[model samples]
Target: MTMTVRDLRPGVRADFEGFARVRHLALPFYLVTPDSLVYDLAHAHPASHFRPLVAEEDGEIVGTAQVGIVHDSPEPGQGYVNVYVHPERTGRGAGTALVRAAEEHLAGVGATKLFAWVLDEPGNRAFAERHGYRGSRSAHFLRLDLTNGTLPPRPPLPAGVELRTGADFADDPRPVFELDSETMSDEPSDIDYEFTDYEAWLEGTWHHPLFSPELTSIAVADGRPVAFSAARTDGGTRYGTVMTGTARAFRGRGLAKLAKADSLQRAREAGLTEAFTGNDARNGPMIAVNKWFGYEICATEVRYVRELG
Candidate 1:
């Protein structure tokens, strides 16, 4: 059978479902839903030229690629094309085909630098190396059993600090956006990002179907958000912390830990049984915080870079 690469029809339920299925099979630690998939496709920035591609064999999706330029970055000509093939469907050229198509699109749009994440395994690393991708930073995915595991008791908030939920920002989320941008600016990564586009953030993140505002915890200081833990739920037992960080001024105060612990406790109270999150391997502080919360390293992935100019 021959495998072919083509653009994904996000409006097509089968296409979104197939992409989510492959992604879930390959990366089961994270939460993904059809609604989230559709929302991402529909609300992505027009300037980024976002394109989702899928590899098919005999009418079955075997791989997927999310190709787009990093429009929000200060640098130009930067692009990303994350490729994930069904674990059971490897060695069939689906991955290679998807990468080739993604590269062509990114290059056509003037992307001189391309990056992808490859699972840190022999075969996966070999595939990326064969395609001229060089290994870079790595990250770890952590999981916790909210139902049976013991979590730290909710710590008392320091004076002048209060814990709040995302729902509290229903009338005006701009403050939360500012806090997120401030914390995200210091996040370790190869790519530098700026969250100046509030409308885009509203569509791409705040209103995302997977986002559980009720479970998201924010630490407030003098009526301002200092740290937060963004929560995402799959409408089931699985809950994920998409981002947990503190502002630069609040780093040494342990506000991030407070926000994350509060969020996880809220997740358990909301009946979520499983919790998942990922942290860069180099982020020792965050990793330690997660460990303190009884989360264990479940899997790891490596970032790979390739130039297509």
Candidate 2:
């Protein structure tokens, strides 16, 4: 009957499990795990000021929010507060409480602009709008039934091109880091990002518990990675493509599609049953490639922005 929002207790296993559970129920298309949650809290860049919040109702977590500033962006004072309430716990006011707490933290930290992602459902959009958030860009969550669907046959590699797994770079992951940095800069997003810190990338992504180096596919040209499809699994049957892109010089050659296809195939062979990925609605090329691979639009989320006064 009573609801309260507070910061998650980092060392508490129940807190992490509850946060991950609510997130999974709210956004099943994405991978969420207790270990990943803990890693994020412990390894976030200091400037990010990351704070994970949970809404408790009678000692049970019903909603969660990941609040932080985009510290790495060239622009300052930009913050994010993504809130997700359990699917079964809607209409309980937990979401509003979490958002209010998140906004207060961001405002105190001098964030001028705050962004959140709301599922495209009418009620979800209404909730954001009622909180003074305006819808902006949108993205699609795609799903492929790897266990039941047929994947495209792996295409022959172009001359002088070779395929490799992220595992191949275990001794030296700087090449994958460079490729990720270059491709990420070109991703379509409302917030512009710069992946400048290799050490940060290693701590935040490369060594994350969910990241699957053995299943990540890379396209190598002249012995350098030009395209890649990074994979992440929930330590279960569900596998997701965290990032898949081709470098600027290799964009039109279908290298991204090739690499991702290989990654998916590898995932299937590795016993992954479900595959999930997300794409910006305006990213036509990537969307087309996903469609070519028989991915269906499972869900959509609209980015919403609210200015702090």
Candidate 3:
């Protein structure tokens, strides 16, 4: 069957399920659902120009791509295109068609440099190179079998330090936002971002469909949030930590570790069986922490970049 690519329709149940299914099939560790997909499409910043595209083959979605401009990056012309095709449908034209459509959308929206994440497999690397992208930095996805593996005992909080869940900040999340902004600026990434808009952050992160406030843990000191382990859940057995960071003033004190350990125990007791997280290959401290919690490297993906005229 011939493949055709089109922007995913928001209200259509088929498109919603198809897009999420394709993502789960290609990258099982990713936390996504039909609700989250539609919420992201509706709440993304206008400047981002985000589009979720799908490649359909005989009425079935065989490929998916998330194309967007880096609206928060300090650099204006940077953009990203992440394409994933159904594992069973590889070698077909689905991937190629999805990439072409994504690239065109990004280029037309004033992008000069485009970035993509290609799996570490030989075929995936060759495919990116065939489309003008060159390899850059890489990241690792780690997984823990919560039900079968043993997790370290919850870390004891230091004197004058208290551990709390994200639900504790329901009335006012400004302090948490401040901590998130500071830590985000220090994260390792090719593009530099300025997270100055609180409203935008609330829309994009705090209110997202899958954000599991009860599962997230925060470390409080001096009456404010000093570190946090942000989490998302599939509402059933799967759990993922999106970010675990500590303020510069609180680093080296094991605050981030305490928050994560607390969060993990919460997930396990809540009946979650799988735990997943990603760390940049260059982030040694985080890798060490995850390893301490019994997470093993499950997959690696290389970032590919292309500069256009």
What TM-score would each prediction reach against the true structure? 0.98, 0.99, 0.99
Candidate 1 lDDT trough over 10 residues, lowest sum:
30-39
Error of 3 at 10 (Å): 1.4
TM-score of 3: 0.99
lDDT by residue (61-143, candidate 1, tens digit) is 99999999999999999999899999989999999999999999999998999989888899999999999999999999999
- Tell me which of candidates 1 and 3 scores higher on TM-score: 3
Pairs of colliding residues, candidate 3? none
With candidate 1 superimposed using the best TM-score fit, by how many Å does residue 84's alpha carbon deviate from the native? Answer: 1.0
Model 1, position 177: C-alpha lDDT score: 95
- For residues 1-309, write the lDDT of model 2, one tens digit per residue: 989999999799999999999999999999989999999999989899899999999999999999999998998999999999988889999999999889888999889999999999999999999999999999999999999997888888989889999999999999999999999998999898999999999998899999999999999997799999999999989999999998888889989999999999989999999999999999998999999998999999999999988
Regarding lDDT, does 1 or 2 come out ahead?
2
Q: Write the per-residue lDDT of candidate 3 for residues 1-309, one digit (tens) a residue.
A: 878999999799889999999999999978999999999998989999999999999989999999999999888999999999999999999999988888888889999999998889999999999999999999999999999998999888899999999999989988999999999999998889999999998998899889988999999999999999999998779999999999999899999999999999999999999999999999999999999999999999999999987
- How many backbone collisions does model 3 have? 0
